[model samples]
Target chain A: MSLPEDYLRYPLRRRGMDQDRYEWRPRADAPRRAWPNGAKVAACIVAPLEFHMLNPSGKPFKHPGAMQTPYPDLRHYTTRDYGVRVGAFRLLDALKRHRVRITFAVNAVLLTRAAPLIEAITADGHEIAAYGWDTDTLHWGGLVETEEAARVDKVRAAFAAAGLAPRAWLSPARSQSFATPDIVRAAGFDICLDWEMDNTPVAMRTAAGLLHCVPLSNELDDRKLLIDQRQTEEEWRAQILEANALLQSEHDRFGGQTLAFTLTPYVIGQPFRIWALDALLSALATDDAVWTATASELVEACA
Target chain B: MHADPNLYDYWPYRDRPRIAWPGGKKLAFWVAPNIEFYEFDPPANPSRPGWPRPAPDVVGYSQRDWGNRIGHWRLMELLDKYAIRGSISLSTALIDHHPEIIEACVARRWEFFSHGIYNTRYSYGMSEAQERAMIEDSIASVEKATGQRIRGYLAPALTHTERTFDLIAALDFWYTCDLFQDDQPQPLKTKSGKVVSMPYSLEVNDVITYGAMAMSPWRYADVLKRHFDQLLQEGERSGVVMCIPLHAYLVSQAHRIRPFEEALRHIASHADDVWFATAVEIAGFYREHCWDQTIADIDRRGLARPGVGFAP
Candidate 1:
C-alpha cells in the first residue's frame, strides 16, 4: 500500500503552532516511549452502530445512482439493523472478555429499537449515550429545530428500559443542535461529547445548565477511514495500532491527560474487521497503563 | 414502524424551534467546490476485452465528473462580489489531481478543509495507522493547495465512526465543520481536548435545498434572507452565528448561478448587521464570548489529570 505522499510532512502550517503542543518523537523511539510517570490519558472507545434496518422501516431505499437496491427486508445489503444487533452482542462479549466497561454512543432511533443491545451495554458495566437519530435526515434538519422533549424521551426511555440512565449524549454524526445541551440537560444528562474544541474534557454550557463536554474526535471513525476505498485487513490493524501509540504518547506527555478512541460497529462490526480490532485490543490490553473504562467513567472522573 | 407523523412535521417544529442564546448574526459561508472527473482511457477494464464499458460502481460513471465540475472561475467571482470568505472542503485527491482548482480557491483567499483524498475512498474499515496517514496526507494536501494551513476538517458526507474524535484531537485542528450540532457554534468534547463544532447548516446549502430541487435564484435568495433575518433577530438579543454552505458545480450551473448572484447582492445589502466572514471567524467569536467556559471545562476534563482520570 502506497502511503499518501503528504503524510511525511511535519508541523503543518495551518495548525503548526497547535501541532507543536503535542511533541513528536522520531519514528525510531515512537513505539517504546511511555507517557510520563505522573502523566495520564483518558481514552474513550465508542462503537456507533448503524441500526436503521432494525426498525423494519428505515433503510436506504433511495439512491442517487445504480447502487444495488436494498431488499424489502433489508437482507440484500447488510441488514440495516443487523449491524446494530451484532454491535450489541459484540459489546456484551467484549466487555465480558476484556472485563472492562465501555460506552455506546447511540442514535435515538436505534436506541429505542435496539432495546436488547442497549440493555447488554448497560448490564456489562457500560454507559448509554445519545448519538442523534436518522443520521442523514438529522444532518439535513440541523439540531436547532429537533423536538427536545421527544428526543429526551426516546433516549431516556431506551436507557430506562435497560435499567440505566445516560448522563451524557453525543449528537448524530457528531452534529449538535444549538439546543442539544438544553435537551440533554433538561433530560438530565450532566455532560456531553459534542465539543471537538480540545483534547481534554471541559465544562460546557447547555440550555439547562453547565454540562461537562469531553473533547471527542472523528479521525478513527470507519466512515472517514473507508471513504474513498475499502481498507484491507492489515491496513485496518495498522490504523488502530497507530492510534494507540498516539494516545499512549500523549498520556505520557501530559501530567495524566485523558484521550478517547471512538468507533462504530457498522464500520468495524464486519467479522473480518472485528478480527483486526480484536487483535489491536489485545495489543492495547498488554499496555497495563491503558485502563479501559466507559464514557461515563471518563466523564464522571473528569467532572 | 413509520416515522412519527410529528417527525415529518417541519411546520410546527419550525415554530417551536428551541429558543436559546441568539444563534448568531455573523455569517461564515463555506463554498465546497467538489471536483469529480472521469476518463475512458483506452483498454478500459483489462479484465473484460471490449466489455461494454466500465464498472458503474467501481469507477465513476456519474452525471458530472469531478474534474470538469470544480474550480469554475465564474463562481469565485460571485463570491467575491459579496466579499464572502469561505472554506473550500476539497477532496484531497481532487486538489492533487487538478492544481488549477486549488489555484482558483487560493486566488479567492478561501480556506481549504480536507474532504479526504477522493470522494470514493471509503474510510470505513481503515486501521489506526492508515487513518493517521490519510489525515496527515489530507492536511498536507490542503496546505499545499490553498497555501493556507487547514485549521478545520469536514468528513466526507459527514459519515464517520467513533475513533475519529480522538484522532482529530490528536491532530490538533482548531475547529472542524464536519458536525451539525446546533444552529449556532458551541464547544463539544473530543478525545484530546475541547474543540468547537462550528455549527454548519445544510438547509441553506445549495446541494439539497437547491441542487436537488430546482430553486429559482430569487426564491433561494429569499430563503437565505429569511434565515438570515431569523438569526440576525436572535443575535440582536443574544450572540448568534449563521453558516451557509455552497457548492461550486451546483451553483455555477448556468440555471442556478442567478441565485448565488442574488444571494451575494442580498448579503451586500445588509453588510452592517450581518457580518460576512469565514467559519473560523464565527467560531472564534463564539469561542471568545458564547463558549469560553464550555471550552475550558472540556480541556480540564479531557486531559489526563493523574488520579483524576476516568469516571467510576
Candidate 2:
C-alpha cells in the first residue's frame, strides 16, 4: 500500500522516542560526495549458507512411511554433490569473479562444518555473519525448549564453536522471534538487514536500541521472479532492470540512501543464474550512481 | 457480523520493545492455522452483503457448492509441492464432511488444531462447561480423523471464554492461539492461573489482509517477500520472529495459490536463512529456549509491564 499521504503528514511514531520530521543523512563514508545524478545502489551477496549432515541438501528430514526402510531421503538436493565446501566454493568463486563482497549469513552449524569456506569467505574480505544455528528460521518460541536464558546459552555455544564473532544476523527464512533484536543486540549487533520498506536504509529501533536497517525491495530477489514459476526469465530480467532503474531514481530523489539486493547462493550461485546476475550488475554499474558493497560495509557506512 | 471493536484498538503501549539478547540471535517461527472453508450452514438470508450468492446447481445434503474445492485442492497441491507443512485449524463439520481433507492433512502430518465445529459456531454464548466440552470434543474428533493429537485451539475469530486457556491446557492440549503477544511463545496466566499463549498473528494472517484485501497474487507474494526481508534484516542486528498464517480455503483459490507458491519457493530457496517448520515445532522450540522465568515474570507482573524486555 502506498504510504497514506497523512502517513507523512503525521511523522511515524514509536514509543519512547518522538517522531522526527524525516531527514535524509549524508554519509561521510559514501564513496561519492553526492549520489550521482541517477539512482545509486549497493549490492550485498546475502547467502543463507546451510551445513549439516542432517540437512546436507538443506532439506528438512522426515520419517519414512510404512513401505520405506529404516530411513528415507526426506532431503532435497539443489545441485549434485551436496556438501557445504563444494557448494560454498562455487558460491565464493562466483562472487569473487564478479568482485562482489558477500555477507555470508552463516547458519552456525554450516559455518562450523564448512570452516574452510568460512575462512575462505573471510580471507576473501567478505563478511561472515550469523544466521541462527539450529532453529530453522525463527524460534517460533521453540529454541532450547525451556527457559529464555537457556536459549541464549545455546546461541552463545553455537557462535563460540564457530570461532567467528558476528555482529549482524539474518533470521532463518526471514523468521524472527520478538526477542530476536534484543537477543542480537545483547549479542552485540549494531544493525539489522531484515527490513523491506524500500531499497534504502532506514533506522529501526527496538528494545535493544536503534539498529540501522538496509530495507530490501522484494523485486530484486530472483525467487519471486523466476523460481516461483510466476514469471519467465526474460520478464524477470526486465523487471529487475525496471526495479533497479526505479531505485536509482528514488536514490536520486532521496539522497544519501543505500539500496541493497539480497541474493541466495542456491539461486544466483549457479552457472546460468550467474549470467543473469552479471547482466543486471553490468547494467547497474554502468550508472555511476550505483555501487556494490557487502551488507556489513553498507551497515558500517550507514550506522 | 459487525467487526469486533477490539480488532481496531492499538495496544501501542503493549507493542513489544526490543529486548536486548547479548549472546545470540533469538529466532521465532509461527505456524498459523488457516482453515478456509469448513461446511457452515449457508447464510440465513443467502443474500448477505459480504458472502457469495449460492450457485444455481448447488448439490447434495448441505446444499453447498464445492466451487471452492478447486482452491482447496490448489492449496493442498502447493503445500505438498513445496513440502511446506502447517497446522490446519479445522472446523469439525469440515472434517466430518470432507474426510479426505483431513486425510490429506494427516498424510502430510500437518498439525491438527481445532477451529470449532464450523466457521459459524463460535463459542460466544456457550457456557464455560460447554466451551470445555467443545474443547474436548474437538480434540477427540480431530485426533480420530487426522490420526494425530490436536494440541492447540484457535477460537473462531479468536472468540472464547476467559477460561479457554485453562480448559485448553486442562484438556491436555499443548498451546492456544487466542492471544498475539511478542513474536515468541510465552505463558499467559489467566485469572485461573493456567493456560498460556503461543504467539499467533492477525498482522501476518493472510485471508483478511491479503486475500480479502483483494491484493493481487503478485502483491501477496511481494507482501510475504517484503516481510521476510524485514525480519531477516531485523534479525541481523537483533533477531525477531516473522509469521505467515494461511487458510486452506482462501489461499487455495485459483487467484491466491501463486502467492503461496512464490512465498514457499522464496523461503525454501533461502533455506539457510530460514527454518521452515510446523507450529508444534515452533512451540516446542519456544518452550525449550525462549520461554522461562522472564515470560512467567512478565505474566506475573499482571499487565503492567507489557511485552518482554531483555535484561538491559
TM agreement with the true structure for every prediction: 0.45, 0.44
True-contact fraction in model 1 equals 0.01
B1-312 per-residue lDDT for model 2 (tens digits): 111111111111122333332244344454454653433344342212112433322342122234235545666666677677767777766776677767766777778788877655555556788888887888788767766777777875455543555567667666676654334445544333334455465444666455334456666676566556645544554445566777654565566676668876876676555556666766655555555643544444322232221111
**Using TM-score as the measure, which candidate wins?**
1
Worst 10 residues of 1 chain A by lDDT: A63-72
Shift in Å, residue B138, candidate 2: 0.6
Question: What's model 2's overall lDDT?
Answer: 0.54
Tens-digit lDDT track of model 2 for A1-303: 697677667454554335231234444433342433433656554666653221222223221110111111111221211224233554565566667676777777655444555667788888876776543334444444345335544665687776766767666555555566566666666556665544455556555676666565556565555444444344656676676666566564455555555555544443234455556656655666666666667766554
Q: Candidate 1 lDDT, tens digit per residue, B171-280? A: 87667665432344545455465456665555466765565434556556766766665555445444445666766556676767776676667657866666666666
lDDT value, residue A121 of candidate 1: 64
Quote the true-contact fraction of every model. Answer: 0.01, 0.00
How does residue A205 of candidate 2 score in lDDT?
Answer: 59
**Stretches > 4 Å off in candidate 2:** A1-303, B1-26, B30-33, B36-68, B191-196, B236-239, B296-312
